[model samples]
Target: MPVTEIESESQFTELTKNDATKLIVLYFHTPWAQPCQTMNQIFKTVADSKASDNSISFLSINADELSEISELFEVSAVPYIILIRNSVILKELSGADPKEFINSLNQFSSSSSTSTSHNGPTPLATATATKPQTTSQPEEESEDAVQERLKKLTTAAPIMLFMKGSPSSPQCGFSRQLVAILREHQVRFGFFDILKDDSVRQGLKKFSDWPTFPQLYVNGEFQGGLDIVKESIEEDDQFFEKALQAAA
Candidate 1:
């Protein structure tokens, strides 16, 4: 079958619950994200190849449009894919890495075929799943390297927010409120979901000496959390504007 665009939550439930479907490939994306443009074609290409196979189904879901489904999978980023089998999450792929998506689909789809005749589908093995082919151990990144990465991430945009979830789907109350504030101010900013990366989540705490999340940064400088942001706005109506001007 061709790739299906899910329009409603009820439709999503009905399609996923189909008894004939042994494998469900879910593509969660938003129109604004540029990476989704590339992954969308990749998803269609692969889905078309297996169009004759009734056991596998591909679904295209807009994260913003289908917020409930995106929330169901805890999807915080666009161009994300989730593989489901027998009501169980088999594997999840993030980002727009075409090779990774294709290889993973092939690996799990073949496994699903074999496992169907036996027991039910099992979750992807976390340990050996993405293990490197080399026999030698891999070297860990140096402290300086990690710091450098954090620096880059902080300045990824003029206004950066390191929060628990995406701006559209905030995982925590503080993050949700912060997003509301930014929107209220009509401020355009970029955000990083710290929940997805433990390294950044933990490293950022030390880097900025801030223990809590929902951290905001202006020009790569630590700007406090939600409370501080509110206070800054209270003190100066043009807080965001001033910060951006300073960066310029």
Candidate 2:
């Protein structure tokens, strides 16, 4: 079964991605909800019926436990189904209707099959998807200025991840892996790319008392570089895991 149970944001990160090739169903819920359990059973039954199909995958994520995914998906109510393909939502529903669920699933399945018939991979239609957080304004906050501003913002969160790129579009392989790992763990970190800011690029070494570009900070404390983070992952230390838990 592609779906088991997602307890942490790390598990959620491993499932969702910017890649447009995967089909994902995110089921968000809470433990104190009796109706949530009933809805989960219904979802499990539906998943069991369609286990043979390899086109899509299922995820059962606890809303209370996985706050990052919950907040990202915005599941204030329990028992919701978010059908996402290529990191975009195609269908969204929150109810106990079996017939409608099956119908929607079938429709997506058919559409997916037809689209996958040709080409190297499923072409993700560009939709000007990302909304710039703040309107692009000209001022001292140029990419250079933003870098300096981002360094201050880095300490804004308990965990700060300063690298060559942001979490989503990493410029280097090390930054990419670190992004994946941080997102997987739902670290709630602030990211800065040295490539964008020359000041922070050179200033961060002295700021965080670290010598590397892809540096990590916990509780506003300097953690280490990519190799250190990778080693933390292997040792099961998950340095930011508890920090996120406490903050959440």
Candidate 3:
């Protein structure tokens, strides 16, 4: 399906509520944000690629214009994306990372296709019989496992930034400033939103012994928050380059 532009709250409701079987990919953005501009192209590309998939729908809404919709989703940042199926939110991602965005869409497409195949051409009785077994699976994660996951995530990329939101759209002022600094220095980095995962958020405070967010990490080692980053940049012009090199 082609990408659709959401003009009003009613339009958004019409698009999402009318089709319970479609997967709605809602993109909340603003024209003023440079990161949003970058993400806009990526979003369109993903939509175009998935145009043949009748089960998926793409929508772009200006956060500034559609304040009601933004507020409903608590979208305080631009370039935020929410994946919905049957009016239920499956996942929410905040950022302008093309690779991650595409990967997510691909995963969803595969999973949704698989689900449809299983559900399609099935007798009502068989479908009902299998539904209960699927719903019985556990959904809990252990504390030790979460810690281990956090450890791996910090070093998932060479330059990792654990912030309140994404590098493109930051939820907090500190995170916004840190993103600006990183961009100003022309640094290529990967980010994880602490706000999205409570386990990572709370576990990190103890893991790195850093209570505050917008924390920078290079090659798995903890760097300080926004204030320390500013001071480091002031003291050394090549702060980012040197830090990355040391990590390497």
Report the number of the highest-TM-score candidate.
Answer: 1
Order of candidate numbers by lDDT, starting with the best = 1, 3, 2
CA error at residue 191 for candidate 2, angstroms: 16
Angstrom error of the Cα, residue 95, model 2: value is 2.4
What's the true lDDT of residue 133 in model 2? 24
Candidate 2 stretches with Cα past 4 Å from truth are 113-154, 157-248
Cα lDDT of model 1 by residue, 1-248, tens digit: 48999988779879988764488889999899999998888899999999987778899999976654664565678899887777777677889998988887888777754333223223221111211111121256567876987898888777888888666588899999998898788776667777766767888999989999899998888889999999999999999999888877
RMSD per model, one decimal: 16.4, 16.9, 15.8
Candidate 1's TM-score reads: 0.50
CA lDDT, candidate 3, residue 170:
67
Candidate 2 vs candidate 3: the lDDT winner is 3
Q: lDDT of candidate 3 vs native? A: 0.73
Q: By TM-score, is 1 or 3 better?
A: 1
Model 2 lDDT tens row, 1-248: 74669866555667676345657777877778777877877788888877887767888887655544554554556677777776657777776666777787777866753232112211112111121121233534455665555445565556666777444345688887787786566545555556755656666777667777688766556778888888877887655676555545
